[model samples]
Target: MPKPVLIVGAGLSGAVIGRELAEAGHVVHIIDRRSHIAGNCHTARDEASGVMVHVYGPHIFHTNDDEVWRYVNRHMTFMPYVNRVKTTSAGQVYSLPVNLHTINQFFDRTFRPDEARDFIQSQSDPSIGEPVTFEDQALKFVGRELYEAFFEGYTRKQWGCSPADLPASILKRLPVRFSYDDNYFSHLYQGMPEHGYTEMVARILSHDNISIELERNFVRSDAGDFSHVFYSGPLDGYFDYELGRLGYRTLDFEEFQYDGDYQGCAVMNYADADVRYTRVTEHKHFSPWESHERSVCYREYSRACGPDDEPYYPIRLSGEQALLAQYVARARFEQGVTFVGRLGTYRYLDMDVTIREALDTARSCIRAFADGLPLPAFNIEP
Candidate 1:
């Protein structure tokens, strides 16, 4: 009999890969350090309010990939959700992404979309030829006033660094709209799972060939027991951080229950640096499909990740990238193991992209296994 494949971490990456491999006739064993599944996207019902709360943080699944969208829908019902974020800045409320409504409200003008665009163009600094830093990109695109109000304070609080120090790529992800389109994500399919992410993951791992164990940690020695190992833990931790610790920013959530509505929206950005926490998320707003008298909210604080903290976002600055390169080199030389997922690859990934990569990775692995070839250390570069 062939040995069962070992999958470390019962998150989306492991679950998707395991499901695909199981369907391909491979027995799979998946484990996670946490008591629950879905990793950071874990959601559970608030016992008192019966509101399905995002335990770690809010995760609204949005994707452009039809295959990925269809795959998730096969497991759980997803209700249509549009994330319209709001921001509190300079003692006034504003729509996020600096849309036409936000610009008009901020400047107290009734300019049309075209006039607004031309006005913004005049506000933008033309001196910046090729933007390098995040500050430069913001100023070149949206001008100082909008940058200061929207990106500056919020970015500093979220990353624990000035926008001037961050790369331009960071600010490029956010889009500035001339119209009143306040939807945070521009993806074609945007929704929340009906039951919750945990339930969806549970359904994905329900096949007879896949067995799961929670609250079980994966160490280096466990690799020998399986035919091949799909490791979704931190790449540095695989070697026990022998080289050095990579930099990461971890989140501290101040969870509180409210008798009624806390915030009108799912997410509210506190753009002022003095505000301390980056944003306050009202979990009830995340699932509009359900009704609840009480609400669950989290005041999210971002800080430098310590050894004991759960790493949220990887700080891929030059210094961290140097250390990551060392870890990547070591990972490449390691045998019989493949590193995958956010922590495994040291990259922040949206749920849709994670699932897409998992599906592709599984197909690649199945093909290699059939051809009696060695598996690559990573499906992507770290």
Candidate 2:
């Protein structure tokens, strides 16, 4: 008889992997430190407002992968959603991602697309060849005026660092559209789960062969009870931070209640250093399908992650990468355990990518089990 598999953390990674393995005839036991499922993407309805509030923050589902899109749809219904981000800079609202409309509004000019492109090109620093930092990238891409107006202060507040200190790749994530299209994401599919992420995750983990235990932490001794373990907890945490802690930025949300609409949008970025909070998220706006007289909003602030704080974004600066390399080397040697998910891999991952990796990992593990071989430490490199 095959021994049951143990999965740490009942988040997307663990749930998806457990479901896949259960269907393959393996008994799966999943556990999470938190009382509820759906790690960071947990969504719950406000009793008073009857609004589905994004507990951690807003998680807009946008994916180019057809398989991932279909997989999510099979479990829950997704309503059409297109994120149109807005930024407040110098007491004025501007369209985000520096689109054609934004350029015209910011500069107070009605230049055509070609003219706008040429004007921006002329404004950009011609001396810079191959940008290496966030500030440099912004200047090269949109010139100093736009960079200072939109990205400079926001990046500082969100990352807890100056734009000049951050890597150029960080700025590359944001797209600068030439047209009037204000859709924040360029993905083929974009939507929000009709019932919320928690309900969707519950459906994903509804396999008969799978069992879950929440508010339970994984111990080192527990590894011996199962044939193999899929650990989706923190990578540094697994080793008890033996090589010292890795750098991460954690978010502090100052939630406020309002009788009427708050921001009038799902997310609003404060592109000024004067504003202590990076962005404000009005939860009610997230689910336009549901109406709510009262709204729940969060003024999000980012800071250095402490020992007890829930780590949000991994600070992959040079020093952190050096420390991460050591942890990765250590994780590779662990027997009968595989590190998975955002925390385990120490990288920022979108929901679709996380599910995709989990599915692939389960298939790989099944092959290993059939061949009577040891389980892999990591299906994807950290």
Candidate 3:
């Protein structure tokens, strides 16, 4: 007596849940609007360059969660990837995340550990007890100089708005180290999937009972056969935005092939507002193990996600949360339906976070069935 399941949107979150349920002996059916399994993490090798380019953009996998790290490694071998992010800001290129090297390079002073700490402390604004805005938080941590140089313009470019309007929680960590540690991530485990994300997802979804339909027309009424329907598509689209549309930011990546090496690094962020394009990613470097004679490059651009734009980041504007509440309320009232993952929950999530959340959600569902606990509409809170 296996419970039939219907999962929409074959993204990482949906894939994770669908796979888990099928492994637990539940019949599962998964569908995606796109022709691929991996949502944004999809990677395909360019036939011309022999370079595995991130179709959406470069996604660097970095996380401190040990369980998540082990889970992903079980499927694919992860290679070492150090995100030495270089940024062009104020007529000069510098290392990002405001490490010791960046501090030294920008200030034109060879400051030792103590000197750097004291110098930075001198520049930081002490008056602000609690940070209220992105600008306030950045200045409080990295000071006016670094904030202005590194974050201000980049934030503007990425958000298509001023940092001053953004929430302080965004600057949770600026990573000011005493040592000259320029490594971007402080995670215990960090690397890219050996076979790329598409394969990783393909591995996750490979099961006897699970059937995946790609580039399929998804109508909510069409999913009536299943006992429980898991919706991972846009929450608005899920409910047809009975209330109103939630705000979001989308990316526009302009790509081209280069004869040889275009940029030495995999990621070069344009922190200064002077550059029209925010960053140039050389996809070849992402796969350092495989040497490509030629290279592929993508100039990353940020813009407002219009009605038709592929929404990347959830804006969560003032009344949007209330609007989200309306959707959640409607979802709760609906029978045999669970809303999980980024789009369904109306929040941006990293791959690792999405995977972990899906795993936990699956476990929660199984436990709920065993212990007679109630299953939630959401796997994770927004």
lDDT of 2 by residue, 168-251 (tens): 998776577778999899899999999999999999999999999999998879999999999999999999998999999999
Q: Name the weakest run of 10 consecutive residues (lDDT summed) in model 2.
A: 170-179
Rank by TM-score, highest first: 1, 2, 3
TM values, all candidates: 0.99, 0.99, 0.96
How well does candidate 1 match the true structure in TM-score terms? 0.99
Per-residue lDDT of model 3, residues 24-66, tens digit only: 8888999888987788889998989888989999888999889
The lDDT, on a scale of 0 to 1, for candidate 2 is 0.92
lDDT of 1 by residue, 139-191 (tens): 99999999999889999998999899999988776588899999988899999
Question: Candidate 1, 169: how far from true, in Å?
Answer: 0.7
Clashing residue pairs, candidate 2?
Answer: none
- Give the residue spans of candidate 3 off by over 4 A: 1-3, 370-374
For candidate 1, the 10 contiguous residues with the lowest summed lDDT are 169-178
Q: Provide the overall lDDT of each model, using Cα atoms, as 2-decimal numbers.
A: 0.93, 0.92, 0.85
